[model samples]
Target chain A: MTGVATLIRQPWLWAWVGALVVWLATAVFTGGKGSGEVLSAAMTFGAFFVIVALGQMFVITLGPGNVDLSIPACMTLAGTVAMKSMDGASAMIPVGLLLALVIGAGVGTLNYSLIRLLRIPPIIATLSSSFIFQSAAIWWNRGLRVKPPEALADFTTAKIAGVPVIALFVVVLAILGHVLLTRTIYGRGVVAIGQNMRAAHLAGVKVERIRAATYIMCATLAGLCGYLLAAFSGGAALNMGEEYLLSSIAVVVIGGTSVAGGFANVPGLWGASLFLFLLVTMLNTFGAGAGVRLVLTGLIIIGVIVAASGGKART
Target chain B: MSGRLSPRLLRSLLPPLSLAALLIAIFWLQPRTMSYFGLNLLLNLAIPIALATIAQMFILCVNELDLSIGGFVSLVACITATWLHDTPLLGIAALAGLIAAYAALGALIHLRNLPSIVVTLGMSFVWLGLAVLVLPTPGGNAPEYIRTLMTLKPAYIPFPIIASVVIALVVHVGLMRSAHGTVLRGAGGNPRSLECAGWSLLKIKMGMFALAGFFGVLSGMALVGLTTSADANIALRYTLLSIAGVILGGGEFVGGRVSPIGAVIGAITLALAGSFLSFLRLNPDWQIGAQGAILIIVLALRVLIGRAEARK
Candidate 1:
C-alpha cells in the first residue's frame, strides 16, 4: 500500500493524470460529427509520435548525454525508399515494409558505428546524420513525390469500428515497447545501464551493444512510423519526418523520462501523447496554422521540461 | 617555450587550417567560382550563418542548445519585411526591436536558470506564430536601398561579406578581451564554481543570452538582404548548422574557450563543402551524407585527441 502510494505520487503518474484530463476534455469539446475523425487522426498521430518518443526515452533514460537527432531523417529515408519501391503495388506492401525495416537497421548500424567507433557525442553525430538523411530523401525524390501502393494506403486510411487502424497499430507497438522495456533481459540491461553505466558494465551488461541496440531500436521504430505516415498520406515528402523531431523529444521528456536517463514511464508517455494530440487538435480547432502549431509545440516542450526540473528539485 | 607550441594554440589553429585547405581546394577545382565575384558571393552567404553560429556558440559553450534561431530569424525578417517595406530605416529599427524583444525573452529564461534549449525552443514557436500573423504569405519585400546595399559590392568585396568580417572581428575581440567575457567564460566553464565565488550565474547567463539575441538579429538582418524577402522557414537549417559550425571550430560548450576566427573558418569550410558538392554534380543527397560523415569524423577526432592528451 505504501509502495502503491509512493508510485501514485510520482511525477510521471501525475503527468499521466493530467494527460487523462486533457484527453477527456478534448473528447468532450469535439463531441459529435467529425469528432470521431478528429480523434482517430489524433490517435494515429500520437501513436506515431509515441514510437519515436519511446526510442528517445530509451536513450534519455541511459543519460550518457545520449540523444538521437537522426531518428526523423532515418524515418524519412526509410519511408522514401519503401514507397519509391512499392509504387502503388498492393503485393509490394510487405516488401516495402521489410525494406523499410532493413533500411532502419542499416541506419541504426551506421549511427552505432559512428558513436562507438568515432566516439562523437551522440547529439552531434545524430544531428549530422539527420541532415545527411534529409538530403538523401531529397536526393532520392529529386523534387518528386513517392506514393505508396493503394493497398497500403487503404490499410493506412482504413478505420475499423470507428477507430483508425493506425491507432491500433500504435497501441500494439506501444504494448510491445512496454513489454520489451519491462520483461526482457535486454530491457532490464537497458534500465540498469541507464541507472549507472559503469555498474551495469561491471555486471556484464554489454553496455556498447545495448547502447547500439537502443539506437537501432529507435531508428527502426522511427522507420516504422514513417511507413505508416507515408501510407496514410499516400506518399512520402522530404519534410514529412522533420516535424516529428522535436515532438518526439517532447513526448519522451513530458512522459517523465529524465534527459540524463534512468527510469521511463510508458504509461506517462501514452497519456502525454494523448494530451499532445488533444492540445494540437484544440489549437487546430481554433484555426491556427502550421506556424502556430510549431510555436505551441516548442513552448509546451520547454514548459514541460522546466516544470519537470522544478518538480524534481522540490522533491 | 621556444621549441614547443601550446596544444591549445595547435587545436585552435586546426579548424582554420582545414578551412583554408578546403577553400584552396575549391579554388583549384573551380578558379572562376573562387574568383573575386565568387568569393564575394561566398562571403555574403557566410555572414548570416556566421552570426547565427556565434549566437549558437554562446548557448552551446554553456552546454545548452538553441533550436529557436530559425524562428527568431523568421520573426525578425517577417516584421522587418512587413512593417518596414517602404522605409529602410524603419526596417532597421524593426529589426532592432525584434532583437531586443528576443533578447529580453532570452534573459528572462536565463534568470529562471532554466535550460536555455527548452526556453529558446518555445520562444521560437511564439515568434513563428507572430511572424505568420504579421505576414502569412511572404508578401512583403525589403526596401530597394537595403536590397541594393546588401547586394552591391565595394571595390572587390560584397557588402554582406564585409559586414560579416567586421562583425566577426568585433565579436572575437569582445568575447576574448572584455571583463564580461571573462565572467561569461567562468559561468559556462563551471557555473557551480562561479556561483561559489559569489558571482551571479543568472546574470552571466542572461548577458550571454542577450549577446546571442544580438547575433540572431544580425544574422536575420543579413538574411533579409540576401533573400530580399522573408519566408517563415528561411533560417530553419541555421539552427543546427550554426551549432555544427561552432563545434567543428573546436569551441568548448562551456565558455572558457571560443575561436571566432575558427568559427568563421568553419563556416567557410561548410560553404566550400557545399560548393564542392555542387561542383562534383553529385546527387545533393551526398551532401547530407558528407555532412554526417564529417560530423562523425570530427567528433571521433576530438574524442581520440582528447583521450590521447589525457593519457599524456
Candidate 2:
C-alpha cells in the first residue's frame, strides 16, 4: 500500500490520471468506440511520441535551458532518408537505418561545434540547424511521395499477443532508456553536469564530452523515431515531423522532469507521451477543429511548464 | 595600428560592411538589381521584417523573447484587413487592447517568474485562434490609406531604403539615446541596481512588452499594406526571421546588448539574400539552408571576434 501511494506521488502520476480522465471523457462524449479500442489505437500513435520524448528527456536533462530544437527536422529528415534509401526494399532496411544514424551524427556534431566552439546560444544553434535539416529533407523529397517499404510497413503494423508491435517496441526502448538514465556512469555524469556545471567540472567530469554525447544521443533517437514513424505512416512527408518539435518538449515537461535539468523520469515521459497522444486523438474525435486543439495544447504546455519551473529550481 | 580603431567601432562597422559587400556582389552578378525600381522590388519585404526585428530586439534587451510576435502580427493583419477597413475606430481600439494585454502578460510573466518563451508560445496560439476567428480565410483587403502609404516611391531612391533608414534612426534614438531606455536595459543587465535606484522593474518590463506589441502591430500592418491582403499564416515566418535578424545585428542573448541600426542592416541583407537566391535560379528549397548557413557564418564570426578581443 505504501509502495502504491509512493508511486502515486511520483511527478508523472498526474499525467496518467489526467490521461485516464480524458479517456473516460472521450468515451462518454463520443459514445462510438469502446474505451479499450480507443486506448489501444491511441497507444499506436503514442509509441511515436514515446520514442521522440525519450530523446527529448535526455536532452532536457542535460541542464538548464538546454533544448534540442531540431528534433522535428531530424525526424523528418530521417524519415526521408529511410524512405529514399529503402525504395520499397525490405532488404535495404538496415542500410536506410544506418544512413539515418550517420546523418543524425553529422547534425549532432554540428550542434556540438556551434554551441561549444562557436559559442552560439543553444536555442539559436538548434533552431538554425532545424532550418538546414528541413531544407535537406525538402531537397531530397522534392514533393515526391515515395512509398514506404512493404515489409517494414507490415512489421510496424503487425500485432503481438493482442498488443501493437510498435507499442511493445517502444516499451522495450523505454526500459532501455530507464536503464541508461539510472544505471550508467554516462547518465550520472550528465545529471551531475546539469546540476552544477562548475561543480561537476571541478570534480573532474568531462563536461564537454558528456554534453556532446547527450546531444548525439538525442539526435540518434530522433533519427530512430523518424525511421519508425515512416514505417507507420505509409510514407514520409515534409510537415510530418513539425508536430514533434514542441510536442516532444511538452511530453518531457509533463513527465515530471525538472525543467532546470539534472533529473529525468523515463517512465513519466512514456506516460506523458501517452497522455498527449490520447488527448489529441480524443479532441479530434470530438470534432474540435485544429485551432481549438492547438490552443488547448498551448495552454497545457504553459500550465505544465509553469507548474514545473515554479518549484523545481535547485537551491 | 589596431589600437587606433576601437572595438566598438569595429563591431558597429562589421555588419554594414558585410551588407555593402553582399550588395556589391549582387550588383556585379545581377546588375538589374541596382536600379531604383529593381532595388525597391527586391527589398520590398525588408520594412516589415525590420519592424519585427526591432520588436524582438526590445524583448531581447530585457533578456526575454516573445515567440508570439508572429502570431500577434498575424492577428493585427487580420484586423487591419477586415475591421480596420470596415470600422477604423474599433480596429484602433482592438490594437490598443492588444498592447495593453502585452503589458499585462509581461507583468504576469515577471510576477510568476515564468519563462517568457513558453508564455509567449502559448499566447501565440491564442492569437492565431483570434486571427482565425476574425478572418476565417485568406482574403481581406487593407485600407486604401495603408496601401498608399506603403507604395510611396521616390524617384531618386527606393521607398524601402528610405523607410528603413527612418525606422532605424527613430528606434535608435528612442531606445539608445533616450534616458528611460537605460532604465529598461538596466532592468535586464542589473535588476537589483535599477531597483535600488527606485525604478519599478515591473513597470519597466511592462512598458517594454507594450512597446513590443505596438511594433508587432506595425509589422503586421506593414505586411498587409504591402501585400494588400491578409491571412493568419501570412506573417508566421516573421517569427524566425525577426530572431535571425536580431542575432545577425550583433545582439547577445544574455547581455542586453543590441543595435537598432545593425538589426535593420541584418533584415535588409536577409531580404537581399532571398532575392539573390531567386535571381541565381537556385531551388526554392535551398533558401532555408542558405539562410541557416548565413546565420551560422555571422554568429561564427561574432564568436571569432570575441575570442580575438579576449586575446587582446
TM-scores of the candidates are 0.91, 0.95
Interface RMSD of the predictions, in order shown? 3.2, 2.7
- Per-residue CA lDDT of model 1 for A198-244, tens digit only, reads 99999999888889899998888888888888888878887888778
lDDT of 1 by residue, B1-312 (tens): 922544545566678777776767777777886667878865667777888888887777666778888778777777767777766687677777765665566555665545555566667677777778777887578766667777776886666557767766887788767877777777667778888889976667666777787888867777787788887777878877787888788876554576776676666566567777666677766886776566566666667667656655
Q: Which stretches of candidate 2 lie over 4 Å from their true place?
A: A1-9, A307-315
Error of 2 at B112 (Å): 1.3
> Which number leads on TM-score?
2
Clashes of 2: 0
* Candidate 1 chain A: worst-modelled 10 consecutive residues by lDDT: A306-315
Candidate 1 Cα misplacement greater than 4 A, ranges: A1-8, A13-33, A202-204, A289-294, A311-315, B1-9, B86-113, B143-149, B156-161, B254-256, B300-311
Candidate 2 chain A least-lDDT 10 residues: A306-315
DockQ of each: 0.51, 0.51
lDDT of 1: 0.75
